[model samples]
Target: MAIHIIDEANRCLNCKKPKCMEGCPVHTPVPHIIQLFKEHQVMDAGRELFENNPMSLICSIVCNHEMQCAGNCVLGKKGSPVHFSSIETYISDMYLDRMKVKTAEQKKQNVAVIGAGPARMTVAVILAQNGYQVTIFEQQDKIGGIKQYGIPEFRLPKTILSRYQKKLLELGIRIRPNTAIGTTLTIEDLLRDGYASVFVGTGVWKARNLGIPGECLANVHFGIDYLANPSAYSLGEKVAVIGMGNAAMDVARTALRNGAHQVTMYARGRRIAASSHEMAYAELDGAEFVFGKAIERITEKGPVFKTSIMDENNRVTGYEEGEEQTEADSTIIAISQGPRNRLIRTTVGLEGSDKGLLIVDENHMTTRKGIFAAGDVVTGSKTVVHAVEAAKKAAEAMMRYMEKEGA
Candidate 1:
């Protein structure tokens, strides 16, 4: 089974200098882990991956392989790139069945991480491993922020998220759900209470609203709200997604999954520029796209909505122009952008952009010393892996600061 899997894994030319690792935000050891699996050392492979990424299992299933590790594989130059994700998943599954040993001794530094999302989870794990008592404060009742709420069941099952949460608990990281940082307990309280340091990883949950006329109509809703409460609205037979980004793709695909007869995506950019690889997968899954156009307005017509499209110059380019007004049970706006600013302002004294994203330095540190921010909050919006990577960097920086102060 191992040899068959190895041969089937697609041989890597194994570039003299591997670019695959460079392409990964978390810098996972791609080729080495694959080689370990190829050699039938599945447990070793799992250990290798775990050393770099705590969320490997979740990522192996959901990551955009085309844009990351596998996309940069030199083997792609010949025919197909190595099936890194599949191989990684296989190794992870095998190791998960066995009893793996912990490699580090626990220490005693108290660290508080805000937001139970990917970035905060990563920081919590690393801090715990380094002998720190890590406590995560999440406003939501559950640990996984967007992963639990924003993403749908089909792509990322709740079971997978629950499993990761279980792992974090086993690692000695404390998760305080239903606890909002700025609301339940302020940063000053955490500091005064003797936390050595606090890392903020609250993701961007605020949806960007379409400023066009008629957006506030009862028939219109933001994608986040729609995904957050799928049972609340009766999705009409036809629906239109107002963006071509991944979130837009997610909204469109989700609409289709919920029984919408037709789903269309509107993008102001070309297909290549607007859609991500995951979005392309969404396209293959039956979401249609109308590239290079923007929705100008939405007007409710009984149970339907009439939408107008505009060109780059803001002139009316097209519409359901004369076509029977499409009955839209709900017009979803997937274009809102922002980080949770209240926490940032209260904790770190950092200002957000007009768009509400936190400003950060190259080290992923905010303007406030001893405080760092990452993930969607810092990058505006990005993939889960990107958030994990940013969190890892922030954790390392925080560790260095703690060490300096201790020394």
Candidate 2:
């Protein structure tokens, strides 16, 4: 089912010096893993990937290949790059059933991870592997965060995500879903309860508003809200999505999937305007685009909504300016933004940006000692791989700090 590996593994010049590894964020050994796959050592290949990334399954599906790993492949300079992502996917799928690697059970220290997202999960896994008893407090009823709720099943299947999650549970990571850290339980409380360190990975769930007039109208909704609860509302015959980012594309594609007759994505920028590669797939799924135009206003006319558009400099432009109102039954706002900092406000000595993401040092340590933050809560919405990298960094830093304190 994976495309990259099925195509490229056989074509690998098996370069003596592979540039693909050099381009990876965590520098995963690409050539060696491919060699293992070619040799039918699928489990070994999966283990090699797991050595650098615990969220390999999720990354395989969501990674921006054209930008990372495969993008830098020397083979790509001449021909199609090795299908590294598909190969990685195949390795995970074929071997995950046989490999029974569990977290090391040494019980050396205690760490409290907030939010059950990728960052929290990664920190918990690393800490657990090092014999640290880790407790994860998640605000939601389930783990996986946006991956479970935000990403559609068509893109990321729940079975793959569940398998990856099961490995964490086998590692003895304690996940307490429906428990919020800065609210239901404070950081001070976690420390008082004997946690050596606390890592926060609460992601940005609050959607950004367009601040236009008709936003307060009945059918206008945040793209996340629609994606998060698809069955609640009918996407109807026509829909206008307000942004060109991945989320906006998801909304448009989702609308099409839900049987919407037409879906149009509006962006103030050009066609290359999308922030991620997933958006390209969404375009291929039949989502239309209205680029280089911004929505000025949305007014309701009878049962439909009229959206006015303008150029970057506020000059009237788009179909709405020429007596052709962009009529849609529903308007989905997909402008990207940050989290609600209600929790960070209660923590002493902790500060956030004006945009409301928690500020942390290179080690992911907050201004407050014993507190570290990662993932979207700290980085303002990043990829699963980035969150895993941050979590690994934070876990190592926490371990060093604990050793220094003689904990």
Candidate 3:
């Protein structure tokens, strides 16, 4: 069923305005890149992609293209849309050299980037390209925070991260993996050690707690715990998921793959936080979707349910009484997350939200001078592309700040 994507590139109508580009958060010129690929200029195509999105190959592979570019494709009105992700993946992989930037203005300032997640990755690459020294401190041995840990291998393979790892290492961006910033070093330490500025993009690390009776039991697991190490974690045959989001969907699908005979997903909201396509994919993988009802409490036997009614505005009206108790061997709490704030609490003058998100001004600078933050640390669990865009904003802000300070 695999068509020669390069040949399929010729099918692009190549819209003048290019809604695909407009629809993209990063504003990648999709039609133009497709044109380059169709003409057999993969290197040229890669350069175009690199101008906007640095993680072209990985994003093309994992991004919800159907919701963005492919969805907006004019051809999608009637016929099939152009396979942009496949074409982009092809160009990025085949001509990676084109994505490499050989020249940047020697800014000569050391910047400390905490966490090796997508936001940090974007900031690191941009700052390094602009001739600033970037050092990333990751708590875990592996980089690519969410991409490396939270995601399932079936969706984004480990090989993709390995390729990116090699590329990042080659960029002369120093990385200290397996080193917790707050424990090993502090924000004051980075400044004292001559890092001109520090960017805190540690991301959302704390999983929301499910306040239920059986939460402390052996078979219960949080979304992060389940998704991070699916192989090592003890799974169950009849798995019950208690949320609806990207993480929730991932848990349900992952459970099905890892010997769970039946995966029952429960969420109270009318709307699922996850994209429809992702939910569909989970459903295709044999996950049982249960909406509008959720577990009020959990017991050793199973979950005690209450049917939640939603208004037209998607707000929960009230829970209808029901004696619904579904039997399951294991339960996974796949709810939202917040910033761990271990490093932030220790540091002085860094403002934060009620929900543990870091507070920043128009310039992406935190309450503390010489320190900036972006991504989920600021916005609380957003998509990878959104994180990248936010990083770009932070990077630009840093550039202006550094210029003012004459670093």
Best by lDDT: 3
Task: Give me the runs in candidate 2 sitting further than 4 Å from their true place.
Answer: 1-7, 271-277, 301-324
- TM-score order, best first, reads 3, 2, 1
The true-versus-predicted C-alpha distance at residue 111 of model 2, in Å, is 1.2
From the highest lDDT down, the ranking of the candidates is: 3, 2, 1
Q: Which stretches of candidate 3 lie over 4 Å from their true place?
A: 97-107, 310-315
Among the numbered candidates, top TM-score falls to 3
Between candidates 1 and 2, the TM-score winner:
2
Report the C-alpha lDDT of model 2 over 6-83, residue by residue, as the tens digit: 556777767777788777777778888888888877888888787788777678778777788889998788887887
For each candidate, the alpha-carbon lDDT, in order, equals 0.75, 0.78, 0.85
Model 1 misplaced regions, further than 4 Å: 1-5, 96-106, 272-277, 302-327
The backbone clash count of each candidate, in order, is 4, 3, 0
Q: Could you tell me how far off, in angstroms, the CA of residue 210 lies in candidate 3 after the best superposition?
A: 3.2
Per-residue lDDT of model 1, residues 1-407, tens digit only: 46655775547655667778888878888878866766777888897787688777767877787778888888776777776877777777666546343526665568889988888888888788777888888898888888888888887888877777777777778888888888768988888898888888888778787677878887788888787768777878778777776677778888888888888777654533333667667878898876545456776841223455666665565655433344455678887557767866676476677777777788777776667788888777788888888888888898888888768
Quote model 2's TM-score.
0.91
Please report how far candidate 2 places residue 67 from its true position, in Å.
0.8
| Tens digit per residue, CA lDDT, model 3, 1-407 | 12678556878888899988887889888888888776777788887776577777778878888888888888888988887888888788766643565637676789999999998998888888788888999999988999999989988888877777777777778999888888868888898999989999998979998676778887788998888888887766898899989899999999999999999999887787888879999999999988788677787766778888788897899888765888988888989888988777778888788888999998889999989999999999988888888899999999888888983
